[model samples]
Target: MESAVEQLLHSGTIIPAHPLALDQYRRLNENRQRLLTRYYIASGVGGVAVGVHTTQFAIRRPDINLLEPVLRIAAEEIAAAGLERPFIKVAGICGPTEQALAEARLALKYGYHIGLLSLGGLTAHTEAELLAHVRAVADVIPVFGFYLQPSVGGRILSYEFWEQFVEIPGVKAIKTAPFNRYQTLDVVRAVASSSRRNNIALYTGNDDNIVADLLTTYRFHVNGEIVEKGFAGGLLGHWSVWTEKVTGLFGRIKNCILEDYKGAGALLQEGIAVTDMNAAIFDPSHAFRGSIAGIHEVLRRQGLLEGTWCLEDHEVLSPGQTAEIDRVTAAYPHLTDDIFVKEFLSQDSIKKLLLHA
Candidate 1:
C-alpha cells in the first residue's frame, strides 16, 4: 500500500512549524541572526502550525507585541528540519482593528511567505470591514483566510463570505476544518474548481479525510486523459504527518499515487486505522484529540520523545488505557519504540503532571 508520504512525493508538499506564543514572540527578532544562519543549514522540512499556543482552558500563553521571535524559531526549525519556507497561521485575539493590523505587520516583518488568519470574534455584520482590514495587512504581507470551524471555535466565516475573501490580494492558501468528511470534500472540490487559481491553495484541515482527500479523490483537470487522483494539497492534522511513522507513510504515498492509485488507497486505509486507534484512547466523543499532542503522548508512552512531553490539555491514556495503547502500539509495530510498559510511570502520574483532569 502507498503511504501518505509516498503520495505526497508525487502530488505536493507538506510544511510543519511549531506554534508561536505572545511571550515567545520577541524571540523572532532577537534570534534572527542565529535563526537566519540556521535556516540555510541542510534541512528536512514539513508543515508548520504557527501563531496559536496550546494550553489548558484555564491559562493561555503569554503574548508579545512582535511576532519575530516565533517566526524566527519557525523559520529556523523548518530550515533545520530541511523543509521549504515555513507557513504561518495567525492566532485570534480579542482586539480592535489596530491590534489586527499589528499582527499583520508582524507577519510581514518576519518574512513569513504564507499566512492563515483566524478571525473568530469578528462578526459577519462586520465582514466587509474585516476584509478591508485584512486587505490593509495583505498590502504589506500576503495572507490566507481560514474560517475556523465551530469544533475549534464557532463559525467565523461562511461560504458566501469566503467567496468574497478569495478576491483579496495575497490571499493564497486556506486551511478549512469542516464539520464532517462530506463538507470537507465539498469545500475541496469547490476551491480546486474555482475560477481563481494562482492565489489559492486548498488545504484540508479535516483530519479524518486528509489522507483520502489528498491521495484518492479526483478533482477537475484540464486534460481529459486521466483525472489525477489525490490531495488538493495544504496541510493534514498534526499526527497524520508528525512522527516518522505517519510522515514516512505520507512520503511514500506521494510517490505511489502517480504510479499506482490502488496501492495508495490501501495505505491510506491503514493510516486512518492507526489514527483512529490513537484517537479512541481519548474518547469516542472527540473525533481527533489534537493530533500533535496525541502522537506526543503515544510516543511518550514508548519513551521516544525523551525529555520532551505532550503539552497540557493533551488527552492522555489512563492507566487502564495504557495497556491498550501498549498493546495497540505493539500490534502495529509501525509505531515501535521498544520500551517495557511495566517500567513506565502510571497513567495517574502522567495525568497529574500533564494537566488537571
Candidate 2:
C-alpha cells in the first residue's frame, strides 16, 4: 500500500458507498451525481465508494453500461476538489473472476485507491474457487473484501475463507456487513490470526451495529499472544445519508477511543437512535427490497436527489416505506444533514463545483 493510503485506512474515516443519481427516465443524472459528490466532499467524508451496492449493480447491464461513466464522474469530482490531503476513492468490483479483474483494472485507470471486491453473486463456487477469484482480482489492484449479508445476494463465507483472504499480500482491507454478530466475529478473528493482521484494516459495514462495532475492542488469543482489533471506521450505506452528521458521529467515536472513555451509556443510546433511523431508511420490514430506494428517498428529500428513481421500476420503496422515513426524519431531526445540505446548495460557488469541465 502507498504510505498515505495505508495511513488513512488504518486511522479510520467515513467512506459512504456512493449512490446512483438517476433521472425519471432512469438514466444517469450527471449533474445531480456531481452535486452528490460535492456534497460528500463538503461534508468531511474521508472517502467515497462508487459502483458499489448502493450505486445499484444493475448499472453494469450492457444496455445501461453506466459502470465506467459513474466511476469517471466521481473521479473527476474528486480531482476537481483538489484536496490537500489524501482522499481515498473506492470502486466496487463484482461478478466472476474475469469481469472482476477487468473492473479492478478500470478502477486503477480512474485513479481509484482500492477495489471493493464484492463476492455476492458467486453463490455456487466452493471456498477454494472463491479464493482463486479473489487472488485473481487482487493481482490487478489492491482489494477490499466485502462480506455482504445473505439477506441480500451474499453467501455465508466461512472463517476459513477469510483466514485465507487476509493472507493474500494484495488484500488491504475488509468491510464486514454480514449483519450477523457471529459472522462478523468470524472475519475479525480471521484477521486477528493473520500474519498481516496489522496491515489489513477492518471496517464495519454493519449498519445495525455501527456504534457498538466502532466502540468495542475485539481481543483474541492468537499464537500465545493477545491481539486487539476494532473497526477503524465504516464503509456504509447508512453513512451515505445524513453524511455530515455521520462524520461528526465518527469523530466523537474516535475521541472516545483515544481518550479511553468509560462512559458507554450515552454512546449506546446514540447507537440505538442510529439503528432506529437505519430501520426506517433501510426498510428491514421488507427484507431490504427497498434498501437502495430508501437511501435515494432520503437524499431526494434533502434535495440531494431529484426523486427516488431506480434502474428497475419495480425497485421503488416498499409500501409504507415513505411513511416510515417520515417518522424517522421527524423523530431524529438531529441525525439528518438537511441544514448543512441546504447551505451547501446555496453557496455562491455551487455552480463552479457542479460545472463539468
Candidate 3:
C-alpha cells in the first residue's frame, strides 16, 4: 500500500459500502449515482467502497455488465472532488481466481486503493483452494477480506480459514461481518497471532453490533505477550444511509478511545438504538431479503435516489418492511440525516459540485 493510503486505512475512518443508483427501468442512473457520491463526500465519509455487496453483486453478471461502470463512476466522482487528504477507494472483488484477478486489475486501473475480496460464492472450495484464490487476487491489489453474513448469500468461514488468511503478504485489512461474536473474535485472534499483526487493520462490518464493536477492545495472549486489537473503524452498509450521523457517531467513538473514557453506559444505550434502526432498515425479520431495497428506500425517502427500484423485480422490500422503516425513522429521528440531506440538496454550491465531469 502507498504510505498515505496505509496511514488513512489504519487511522480509522467511516467508509460506507457505496450503493448502486438506478432509474425506474433498473438502468444505471448516472446523475443520481454521481449525486449519491457527492452526498457521501459532503457527509464526511473517509472513503467509499464501490462494487461491494451494498452495490448489489448482480451488477457483475455478464448480461448486466455494471461492475466497471459503477467503479468508474465512483472513481470519477472522487477525482472530481479533488480531496486534499487521502480518501480510501475500496473496490469489491468477487468470484474465482481468474475473475477476481481481472476485477482487481480493473479496480487498480480506476485508481482504487484496495480490493475488498468476498469469499461468499466459493464456499464449496477447500480452505487451501480458498487461500490460493485469495493470494491470486492479493498479488494484484491490496486486499480487505470480507466475512459476509450467511443470512444473505454468504457461507460460514471458519476460524481456521481466517488464521491462514492473515498470513497472505498482500492482505492489508479485514472487514469482519459474520455477525457472530465467536467468528468476529476468530478474525481478531488470527491477526493477533501474526507477526505482521500491526500492519493489518480490523474493521467491523457487523451492522447489528456497530457501536459495541467500535467500543470494545479485543485482547489476546500471544507468545506470552498481551496483544490488544479493536476495530479501527467501520466499512458498513448501514453507514451508506444516514452517513452524516454515522460520521458524527464515529467521531465520538474515536474520541472515547483516545481519552480512554470509562463512561460507556450512554454509548451502549445508543448501540441498542442503532441495532433497532438497523433491524428496520436491514429487515432482519425476513433474513435480509429486503436489505438492498431497504437501503434504497432510505435514500429515496431523502430524495438522494429517485425510487427504491432494484435490478430484479423480485428484490423489492419484504411485506410490511416499509412500515418497519417508518417506525424506526419516527422513533430514532436523531439517527436519520433528513435535515442535513435536505439542506445539502438545496445548496447552490452542491449543484455546482454535482455538475463536475
Best by the TM-score measure: 2
| lDDT comparing candidate 3 with the true structure | 0.90
Most lDDT-accurate candidate: 2
Please provide TM-scores, in order, for all candidate models, with all chains considered together. 0.65, 0.97, 0.97
Please give the lDDT score at residue 100 for candidate 2.
92
Model 2 score (lDDT): 0.91
Looking at model 1, report the run of 10 residues with the lowest lDDT sum: 20-29
Lowest-scoring 10 consecutive residues by lDDT in candidate 3? 348-357
How many residue pairs clash in each candidate at the backbone level? 40, 0, 0
lDDT of each: 0.47, 0.91, 0.90
Model 3 C-alpha lDDT per residue in residues 1-357, reported as the tens digit of each score = 678878989988899999998877889888888889989999999899999988998999889999999999999989999998889999999998889999999999999999999988787898889999998888899999888888776877778888899989999999998899988988899998898798899999998999999999989999999999889999999999999999888888888777886557777899999999999888888988898999999999998888998887778899999999999999999989999999998989667644641
C-alpha root-mean-square deviation, candidate 3: 1.6
Total colliding residue pairs, candidate 2: 0
Q: lDDT tens digits, residues 136-226, model 1?
A: 7567555655645665554545455565667675676666666465555444554554555444666655555556656665556633533
Q: lDDT tens string, model 2, 1-357?
A: 568877999899999999999988888889889898999999999999999999999989999999999999999999999898878999999999989988999999999989999998898999999999999998999999999999998989888999999999999999999999999999999999999999999999998999999998999999899999989999999999999999888888888877886566688888999999999889889999899999999998887888999998778899999999999899889888899999998886775644542
Q: Name the runs in model 3 displaced over 4 angstroms.
A: 349-357
Query: Candidate 1: lDDT of 264?
Result: 71
